[model samples]
Structure formats: C-alpha cells, structure tokens
Target: MRWFWIDHFVEFETGRTAAAVKNVSLAEEHLHDHFLGFAVMPSSLVIEGLAQTGGLLVGEHYQFNERVVLAKVSRASFHFMARPGDSLTYQATMQDINENGAMVAGTSHMGDRLQAEIDLVFAHLPSRENDERELFDPADFLAMLRLLRLYDVGRQSDGSPLTIPAHLLQAEQAMEAATDLN
Candidate 1:
C-alpha cells in the first residue's frame, strides 16, 4: 500500500518548482500513539512530506520515465512542532538534474512561519528493457496525481496552464477500464 502525505499541489512547474500542502488533524491514527496528549506531528513524517514534494518534481523532469527514489537527506532542520489544525505547506525548488539523479531544496511552512528546511538528493534508477512489464503504470500514477489535484493549479513560469500529455491520460483510462472488467 502507498501512503501520500501531501493533500494536493497548489503550484507546480516542470524542472522548476512546486508547492504543496498537508493538513494536520487530530483524527489521524498516528497522532494517537505519537506522544498521546501532545499530539504534534513527528519530525520524520514532516521530512517524508518534503521528500515526496521534491521527488515528484524531479521525476516529472523525465516525464517519470525512471524510478526516482530519495537517495540521501543532505540536510534537515525543524524550527518547531506542528500541531493539529496547522497546515504545512511545502515549497520545493530544483537545484540540478542529470542522468544520475537530481537535487532539490525544500521548505515547510505554516503560513509565514518556517517550520522545516530540507535538502534532498534523488537517485533515478533506469528501467531494464528486457523486463516484460512497463517501467511503471503511468495510468495509476496519473490517477493519483489527479487525486492530488496537481493538474488543477499547476502552471508554467510563463503563467500558462500545465497540461498532462494525452497519451498518459489515455493509458490511465485504459488501465481503469481493465480493472473494472476483472
């Protein structure tokens, strides 16, 4: 099973930057066991959110052709604890990208207050052509992106709306239809 920390993207630009938000609530199961009464969000989970924000920004550069994984956390620092009713917004800016991997600097903020800063390095693992299955199910990933509303507010630096390729959309629909039949 996959777990997504970000609720949706408020801004996204290919090979550039992205901004996303995550709402912390008391109802979350993790909060129950995490220090009981003082249910502040854990620092590790906060870092995970930042990683997700940056990882996707890197993967999108290659049109998600390769598996982009968190290679290293070069740096991470937290200014304060995030409590229920707080909304953490993550901003990620790409530093560099190459055949080997990518680097991104990300920050988590609650309104104007800085909560955390993270520097991440991602390793892009190429797919083996000899493998029968596709590198990844673009369809499923597209659906997840749609659910994240990345397409809703995503735009390029020129202010034009970001558009997902038609082929990827078609692949997603086909995959969904096949699942329905089973």
Candidate 2:
C-alpha cells in the first residue's frame, strides 16, 4: 500500500508551482503513538508532504515518463508543531529543472502562519526502450493523479488546461483490457 502524506492539491501550474493540503487529525494512527500525551504531526512527515507536492510537480513536467525520485533534502526547518485540527498547506515552487533533476523550494503553512520551509532535490531515473523497469504502474499512477484532482486545476505554461499524456492514457486502456480478459 502507498502512504499519501498530502490529501489533495489545491493549486498546480505545470513546470512552475504546486500546492497541496493535509489535514492533521487525531484519528490518525501515528498521532496516537507519536506522543503518549500530546498528539502532533511529525516534522519528518511534514517534509514528506512538501516533497510529495514538489515531486508530482516535477513528474508531470516530463509527462510522467521519467521516474522522479527525491534525491535529498537540502534544508528543512520547522516553526511550530502541527496538532490535530490544524490544516497544513504545502506549496512548492520550481527553482530549476533539467533533463537530469530538479530543485524545488517548498513551504508549509497553517493558515497564515508559516510552519516549515524545505528544499528538495529530485533525480530522474534513466529510461530506455529496452529497459522495462517501472518505478510505478502507469495505470495506478494515472488513477492517483485523478484521485488528487490534478487535472481539475492544473494548467500548462501557456495557460491551457492540462490533458492526460498519451502514454498514460494508453497504459490505462491496456490495463483495463487485460482486466476484462480475466
């Protein structure tokens, strides 16, 4: 099973910026044990949430053809503890991107208060026609994007609506056909 730190995306601009929200809740299993008396969202998890937002932003830049993985956290600082009932909005802005990797500057905010700042570096795994390895199933990845409502708010650099990449669409169709065959 995949663990999603972000609940949903609220803003997305292709190859530029993205923002996602995560609602901290007492019902979460980690909150109960992370501290016996005081329930607080871990700073590590907050960084993960920011990374997820930035990672997706970077992945979409390559049309999800390249496997973008977080290479490192260059910097991270937390201002305050995120307790239950607080909503954290993570925003990521692209600092630089190229064929090899990308640099993203991100911040976490609770309403108007700044909660955390993180710097992330992502590396794009090499892909070759002969190499059949996939970091994630394309069909599942497409489904995950839909669940996040990325296309609903995403836009191209030219300000056009974002469309599903042809490769991903074909993968989803093939998966559905194989499922029907069974």
Candidate 3:
C-alpha cells in the first residue's frame, strides 16, 4: 500500500526511540468517504501509519536484511479524533529486541492531545541458505531507509543513493499491469 501517512522522521536514535510526523490535509482522498462533514482520519489507518513508522525503525536497526512484518499488536487505544489540518506526531520507543522479533511502544499526538497509543510486535524471517542471494541489496535498503527518513539512525556508514531491487521492481510492475488490465 502507498503509505497513507507520508511521515518524515523528526528524531531517531537507534535501539532507543524515534519520532515522526504526518500532516493531515483535506485534499486526501480518504477523507471524502470517511465522513460527510466531519472528516476525521480513520483509526485503522492511523494505527497503520504508526505501525509503518515503527516497522521502519526496527527494520533499519537490523539493516533491512530480515523480512519483517507486524506480528501482533499487544495493546492499542485511541483517545481523540484526528481531523484535517492537524499534524500528527508519532513517537515509538523500543521495548525489546531479539534475533527473531522486536517490540515497541508507540503513541500519536495531535499537538497536546493524545490521539492514539499502541504496542507493536514484529517478526523477522531469516534468510534461507540458497535463496537467490536473499534479494536484499544494501542500496535498495538504503533507498527505502532514506524514503522513510530513517537513515539518520547513525547506522548507515556509507551514504549512497538507494537502488530498487529487480525482484521488487518487477513485482510492482506486475501489480501495475494487473491494475491496468482490471
């Protein structure tokens, strides 16, 4: 999915915490169907935004080599409605990390109002012995990292432009083709 929340990292410290921001705009298409007059951002997408930010943090910490996905949400709560013209700040802190998985606690705030809180767990898939070089290029990883503004984590030693992997590029192309066909 295209990132619903195009977040930019404001603060990041590897193995510790990270903060990102997403500005809500009335021009966003989802707002049209969300509510008639009151275009409050959907809670599911808010959680997704937080998860994507948090997932990027964890993935970058591990050098984007492992196949990581959101395994579970331990706890999630929403307090206030996120409306258009609001800028949401999402902050996530690592609770624990291991070779197999990691946990993070995250909170989203709209100015002084708490919008949502979540505890997320992520699972890592190890590379197989003979899996076509694992299909993870450092350049592609770096590009995704940069796109997510996660390269500021002090872990990227080489500052190089990221390259998209051929496999992923092909998959995306196929998806586009299918959409066109449909």
Candidate 3 overall lDDT versus native: 0.75
TM-score of each: 0.91, 0.95, 0.76
Clashes of 2: 0
Note the clash tally of each candidate.
0, 0, 0
Give the residue spans of candidate 2 off by over 4 A: 128-130
Q: Candidate 2, after superposition: displacement of residue 180 in Å?
A: 2.6
Candidate 1, which ten residues in sequence have the lowest lDDT sum?
127-136
Q: Mind giving the per-residue lDDT tens digits that candidate 2 earns over 1-182?
A: 57899999999999999999999999888999898899999899999999999999999998987889999999999999999999999999999999999999999999999999999999998777898688888999899998898988899888899999999999999999999999
Worst lDDT 10-window in candidate 3: 153-162
Candidate lDDT scores, in order, read: 0.88, 0.94, 0.75
Candidate 1 wrong stretches, greater than 4 Å: 132-136, 179-182
Candidate 1 per-residue lDDT over residues 63-168, each given as its tens digit: 7666798999999999999999999999999999998999999999999999999999999776667764554578878988888888888776788887786768
Candidate 1's displacement at residue 63, Å, is 1.3
Estimate the TM-score for candidate 2. 0.95
Expressed as tens digits, the lDDT of each residue in 1-182 for candidate 3 is 44547467877766667788888888888887888888988888787887877887687676565777889999889998888899999998888888998999999998888889999998887767776354345444445556766655333325342343355566556766878999
